[model samples]
Target: MIKHAALVSFLMHLDYFDAGNMDSFVDDLTVIPAGRGTDAAGQIVVCEMEYTGVYGIADYPHVQYPVQRLLAQISAWLLDHDTDRTTPFDFSVNVETNPRDDSKADLEIRIPFREAVTASADAGGELALAGEHYDVNA
Candidate 1:
């Protein structure tokens, strides 16, 4: 299981805010369909709703949501998918930063249209997991 705490810290980095020493890093990280594909963009969209444990209801201006919140969201998002995977998933949007390995380096997600996970005779309905040859089909 990916360390929720660590992933949380990493996501925080994406926010581009100046919150000091937020803890958003992952440990024991693993990927579903393991090593599915290469880096593609515009797959995920984020709707950051809060910052520094602050959420809004009425409305605020120029609010900077904590980056870690988004990271945690991504960690949670990965948990929802099937490890074996199914069909080509077009996109995965979240307020979190994209996942990474132990070093906090980006673990490229976002497969392209063509590279998008798909069913195959050999692999069955299993979506392509990360693989050495996996390039974003898009």
Candidate 2:
């Protein structure tokens, strides 16, 4: 499982937004298993995971440039930190204005990654599984 607090901290470290703004800007942060597939050798199960959240920003004049820059920065950060080269990294973003505050909008971001896991089971017995969870980009 990905820790929301840790992700928020990572974003703060990027300096795009300040600590005080975190509570207002970031929400519903989570990492979930999206799908699973076996590797070429069939020795490991590759699980596709998605890290997603809604980032709130002030909607104002000339806001497009900043939003674009923010997206680029996030993409770079993800590529630099959590990529394995063999697996493709994918991300998507959607913007929507807040109903309560037209001046505010949210950037819904989704980043996907692959994780390897080992699974085992015995007849009429319990199933045992183990996996390593990657941080941030993973």
Candidate 3:
């Protein structure tokens, strides 16, 4: 199964605060439908929501609402789909608050996944799981 521990480990290498890397990071780690296609396999859904003009914590609902909705969608998708649990899936978000403007913040959501493959070794020879040549003579 896709363990929480493995997901945490994958997240440790990410630097969400780096704007230059944001595009690549999001692109590489998003799993969503593409080009009017229904197949979500090998794709990630990325959502970025921004909130502005808030003056206090009490006014944070504007930001919270969209985030909550996106999270719900992601949660629902994960639950509804019968995916290969052993393959790693990334369901994570990065929230950034403006340093100069406390009222401004953004939420970045990513759900990276891979298409499941169900096959055993082909006839005549076996496939090497690690891409190394097998010692057939041995």
Quote each prediction's TM-score.
0.20, 0.44, 0.29
Model 2 CA lDDT for position 74? 61
Measured by lDDT, the strongest candidate is 2
Query: What's the lDDT of the predicted structure labeled candidate 2?
Result: 0.43
Candidate 2 — which pairs collide? none
TM-score quality measure for candidate 2: 0.44
Residue-wise C-alpha lDDT for candidate 3, range 53-131, written one tens digit per residue = 1111112233324445534643554455525334324433344433233443444444444432222332343434333
Off by over 4 Å in 3: 1-65, 82-104, 110-118, 124-126, 129-138
lDDT of 3: 0.33
Q: On residues 1-138, what C-alpha lDDT tens digit does candidate 2 reach at each position?
A: 243344455666765544454442334434344334344332234343333445444432224335567677766665665554343334444555343243334444444433333332323323323433322213
Worst 10 contiguous positions by lDDT, candidate 1 = 53-62
lDDT of each: 0.31, 0.43, 0.33
Query: How well is each residue in 78-126 modelled by candidate 1, as lDDT tens digits?
Result: 4553232344343343232333333242222221111123222223323
Name the weakest run of 10 consecutive residues (lDDT summed) in model 2.
128-137
How far is 16's C-alpha from truth in model 3 (Å)? 20
Q: Candidate 1, residue 69: CA error in Å?
A: 0.3
Best candidate, TM-score: 2
Error of 3 at 112 (Å): 8.3
